[model samples]
Every structure is written in C-alpha cells, then in structure tokens.
Target: MDDDENLPRKTNDPLAALVKQDLDPLSVDELDERISALKSEINRCEAKKSFAVSHRASAENLFKK
Candidate 1:
C-alpha cells in the first residue's frame, strides 16, 4: 500500500467546485448574484497576477545590475 493512500483526499478548489456545482437548482436572481461574485473574484485574481508580474520584473532588473 502506498503512503499517499492513507492521506485524506484534497478537496477541489473553490473555483473548480463552483464550476462543478448544479446550476439547475439556483433561481435566475441567484444565478445573477453568483455571476457577479465570480466576476469580482476574477478581477481580484487579475490584479494579483499583474502585481506578481511587476514584482518579478523588478527582481530581474535588480539582479541584472
């Protein structure tokens, strides 16, 4: 038996779980609300990605000197 088998399974990420969820159960208004929330999360992720890219560029420039 593998040691990894004894460990508990890792849960799916929030985004992954969201994608897998049953949308049929939600009302039209609830679906709209979820879409808005997902959009904000996407914006937040994009900002973080931009910051990371900028930071990496800065680090590279510092090391090149």
Candidate 2:
C-alpha cells in the first residue's frame, strides 16, 4: 500500500470548505441554512442555561426555608 493510503483522512469542515473554494461561491440559501442551524444551536444552549439557573434558584430557596 502507498504511504498516502496509510495517512489518516481529515474531517470535513463545511465552513472552511466553503471559504477555501473560490470557483463555486456559497449561495444566499446556503448562508440562510447556516444561520438557521446556528440559531437552533443557540436556542439549545440558552435552554440549558435557563434550566441550570432555575435549578439553582430552587436549591437556594430550599436552603433558605
């Protein structure tokens, strides 16, 4: 087998791939999709933060009682 074949493959970076390629530019729709995906991820993180805050509040109230 060739040394090239023995080398591990790099994981695909969609953003970097888009940035690297000059021949085919990213479309508006593709940008929107990326934005939507980021928004969803943000919402998920926010939900987790809110849950942690509420849980902390509940624990504090219990301690005070």
Give the lDDT of residue 11 in candidate 1: 89
Taking all chains together, each candidate's TM-score versus the true structure is 0.78, 0.58
lDDT of 1 by residue, 1-65 (tens): 99977876558656557767999999999999999998999999999999999999999999999
Model 2 Cα lDDT, one tens digit per residue, 1-65: 78876765565956457446563465989778877987898899999999999999999999998
Top candidate, metric TM-score: 1
Shift in Å, residue 13, candidate 2 = 13
Q: What are the Cα lDDT values of the candidates?
A: 0.88, 0.79
How badly does each model clash, as a count of residue pairs?
A: 0, 0
- State the displacement of the C-alpha of residue 56, model 1, in Å, after optimal TM-score superposition: 0.2
Stretches off by above 4 angstroms in model 1 are 1-10
Model 2, poorest ten-residue lDDT window? 15-24
